[model samples]
Target: MTEQLLPENVQTWAQAPLPTAPPEPTPAGRLTIASVPAGHPYVRGISGADDGVVRLRDPLPDPADPDRWWPPVVLDAAWITQNADVVDVVHVHFGAESLPPGRLAGALDALDAAGLPLVYTAHDLTNPQLADQAPHEADLDLLISRASAVITLTDGAADEIARRWDRTAVVIPHPAIVAEGATPPPGRATGAFTVGVHLRDIRPGIDAVGSVRTLLAGLTDLRAAGVAAAGRVVVNDRVRDSDALDAVAALLTDRPDCVLVRRPRVADPELEQEVADLDVALLPYRHGTHSGWVELCHDLGVPVVGPRVGYAHEQHPDEFTAFEPDDGVSLARAVLAALARGTRPGSGERAALVQRRALARVVQHRAIVRAHTDVYRTVVRRTGASA
Candidate 1:
């Protein structure tokens, strides 16, 4: 197939060799980064450091809906062209969900014309919101091909990026989402095995109902086989579809071992508590890329049972359980395996584990921040030399 030419104004490095290894640049004054949607947990976690290496600009509210911080102000070509004088670097994290290819290309052109480099953290290779991968792939084709530097969460993701785009990306670990000094919820009843399933505004990638049914079935099977004397599955969902909501409630109605909790929405505190409260958290995503939720679970010493999609298994083999996606039986067997391992620790031991995990997160997040700071400095230095 003949390669279609980009519009006259669009700039791309698709044919260029992989970027050369960058020399470590010396850090100086605070670098102002215009990170799209700076309020996201991942972005905030990485940038939340006392060391003044990077200062991120707060994302402007959405023009259409003033309550949200999406469709970031920096995404506008006019905004970038106007604000480029102040933004040292434009780092894109999560606000590319709506941009078409031509518009994304225009944003890149604006950044280039203004002499501002772009640093894109490839959070999602396949956008969770979209059912189709083509549009997202096209968007990445332009963005990844032109980004001055690209960052991703896992080595597996980086390898995939290299294979797909012929571009090299730095692998930076995801930072902790839970705040430091967070207290895990009070332990469950002694000798009780409990798992949590959260269906918060289900995404296209997730099969929430199927996953919940699988969990209930798995727990029921485990109990019947004497693998466990008693087991519980706690489900949390918000005020959404009335019928879907009723179905969940009805499924658990007769099953005394299973309980469904309906709330308006999951606030941050509740989210943290939910992680701490679960002996295990079940993830039902059949297809997707990476996860901040899994990291959050890890931060609180909660093990996750995610599907065998994306790099979740590769990200932390020992810490997570991967089951064949779309197979309720496979998911049931995986949960049973987790139960067969052993009972959760007592309060004293649990406290110690929580402390250890929390401390590890602190060190990991700081290191991640330093690594990103290095990347920013390197990109700025290279941009300066090229100009």
Candidate 2:
């Protein structure tokens, strides 16, 4: 039999090369970056002190809500004009979904007037939070057309960007979410496999009801086959009042085999423990580009079953199993395939692997940070030379 070849994007991720040379300093002794939402884990993972780049703290639009950074203040033309002296370049990763095309264009015009180059990371080609795709596409059209450089996490996304806007984007792998040397929880007792489906607040991109039902169906089939299996559904307390939550509850009614967990949004440590306790994590995204959840599960050494919609599979091809979105049978097969790969490592092996992966992430993170620095320097230089 002929060996099946992996997709081009999968191969690209598998063979992605890392930069070893030390990064050069910025033309300015130290460059300050105005990351739209600097508090996000992905943004923090790709930034470091040694890269000659400092990301400014996210502006507080609402004083009462300190954690909120939506409708990023730096995207405002007025904010950019006032802070132009301190911020060398604007690197927008998220929060543009909250802005209309006209406002985002005005912000880009401001950056042009101030000679501040824009480096946009296409994190979400299709905004997962919104039901409609047109608004997000409009935002992408403006941002990509005006950006001095573009960055994306997966090669698949890069290809899409090139095809859509005729622009090339630098591909950088997502860094580990769990901190270095972070240990995964001990593996669960043998003979019982747990499948987890976290429908946190049922975002527009997530098929919460469908995912839960599919998990229930899959678990039922597994049990009928004499393979011990259980399903767990996790949802945020904030979604309790929503119709999606009601639908999910109705599905779980009288299902003695499935357990439903409800809680507020959790911090990293809590989340890590939660995911580490499961045998497999199910990603229920109906439509979106890429996922940090996949990265989180990888960091915890837990296998993930994700939809084939985006580059989630490409993110970690070995650890990820793909199923068609909203298809129960496909999900069942994917779950079975994932569990059949064998139990996650024992405690000692898990600890050692986590340490080794952590060390590797440190190195890869440096490369990611260096890549951002290089983009910043290149854009700044081009802007200065033209001036």
Candidate 3:
């Protein structure tokens, strides 16, 4: 049989069905699952899905506050306090931050009081900035110890938690949505044969600014090597004081040799489209365990460059070379080497390797959902669920 074709921009994957908790049997109770995401898009995305047990509203859309960590707790407490009987299980993915307001805590307490479970999936400090791991470990342990069951997206994350907390967590990697950047027309960049990229604000500290400065200096060297590059580095100055950004901006303001523009975060597709024009993507992060962005590039067959902090062992481990976070001299050589390599496909066959690998790396998330259903089954048996 011939293979059928689908639209390029279609989002083919979706959350799998919940088996443990069958659809509302008769007028029987519902599986009230309360969840909230770190970002507004995820919050709106998941909550709007008809599959959730207890749909939660999004919190304030501020992505810069260090204290705005427990967005789920805020969204959850609101639901449970007002309608405790409706929320059977509170499922949340967040880091170790203070719980929401007192009423919300009271609501969560009420759920526990009623024998409902609180399930938490840890995706916090995804790229931790703390100098010491002890505090981070403690915070994570505290949260997991309190949760009825814990879920994670990587074996790395599972190992990190089990080693410290003396408890195991189920591994479920994040899944992928469909990518439509198979073919782009005309010049790859603003100019012929040039590549463009954007590294949004690394964070709100001095070290992050220093990382940007080092990357800019490196891009300048790449331009000097004749690989014309035009891109921007978004800096969320609101995360810190204006003085911090002003100081960082000074370094780029004088550079006429390179086109180093600065801007804010944008929609996902806009960013992806920006990446599609480039032959390669540059991470240049000083710290982090893994990156979803790197996955984005590899999935689309767009080569990536950066320090070795992303999920290197799994995707393009040999394809990457590291550079000192704040050292301009070392970064300069690395950027030049990356720009010299070509990423254009020939006869629609070149990117096949990357396209296949990206799909394989992403399906792990679906496996995660299956594992979660198992946990739900165990919980159901213990709770005397008819299903």
Best by TM-score: 2
- Per-residue lDDT for 280-318 in model 1, tens only? 778767578887778767666667787777887766667
| Most lDDT-accurate candidate | 2
lDDT of 3 by residue, 213-240 (tens): 7767666666676666544554432333
Of 1 and 3, the candidate ahead on TM-score is 1
Quantify all predictions' global Cα lDDT against the true fold: 0.67, 0.77, 0.49
lDDT of 2 at 291: 85
Q: 1-387, model 2: which lDDT tens digit per residue? A: 001111223222222222222223335577878898888777878888688877778776655557656667778777777776667889998877665446688889999999899999998898777788987888899999899999999999999999999999999998888765556565554446778888876778888887887888787777777878778898888752389898888999999888899898776667677777778899988888988888887777778997786787889898899876656677778888987763553556555656666788888888988988899999989888221
Q: How close is candidate 1 to the true structure, as a TM-score?
A: 0.84
TM-score head-to-head 2 vs 3, winner? 2
Candidate 2 matches the true fold with a TM-score of: 0.88
Task: List candidate 1 stretches off by more than 4 Å.
Answer: 1-28, 48-50, 59-66, 229-250, 326-329, 340-346, 385-387
